[model samples]
Target: MSPYSHDFETLEDSLFAMNIMILISMALPLLNVLGYFLR
Candidate 1:
């Protein structure tokens, strides 16, 4: 396998992780608001 491909895979993994973090960050506040309203 090529070194460039390996680097690209690592970059993709990091981006995926960042996306998950961003999604969770966005979701938490919404969840909190939902819980507050539901309560």
Candidate 2:
């Protein structure tokens, strides 16, 4: 593959990883809040 495609692939992978991390972080806090309210 071309260097440009390789760079884009790496960048896309990184962005996807970052998005997953953010979602996990958000979900944990939201769950904690719900648990506190329920309990």
Candidate 3:
């Protein structure tokens, strides 16, 4: 039970990291478009 809980915690952390990465990936393209329009 303890090991399973530990694994679950790690999985949650990884999922959080993945979400952050996905947001950044999405933002980069939008930022580029904004910059191009501003220029």
In terms of lDDT, the best-performing candidate is 1
Task: Report the Cα RMSD per candidate.
Answer: 0.4, 1.1, 1.5
Top candidate (TM-score): 1
Give the runs in model 2 whose Cα sits over 4 Å from its true position: none
How well does model 1 score by local distance difference test?
A: 1.00
Instruction: Specify the poorest-scoring 10-residue window by lDDT in model 1.
Output: 1-10
For candidate 3, write residues 1-39 as lDDT tens digits. 699999999999999999999999999999999999999
TM-score of model number 2: 0.78
Mark the 10 consecutive residues where model 2 has the least summed lDDT.
1-10
Error of 3 at 34 (Å): 0.6
Q: Give the TM-score of each candidate.
A: 0.96, 0.78, 0.81
* Candidate 2 local distance difference test against the native: 0.98
> CA lDDT of 19 in candidate 1?
100
- List model 1 lDDT by residue over 1-39, tens digit each: 999999999999999999999999999999999999999
Cα-based lDDT for every prediction? 1.00, 0.98, 0.99
Candidate 2 lDDT for residue 25? 96
Q: Candidate 1 has which clashing residue pairs, if any?
A: none
Error of 2 at 3 (Å): 1.1
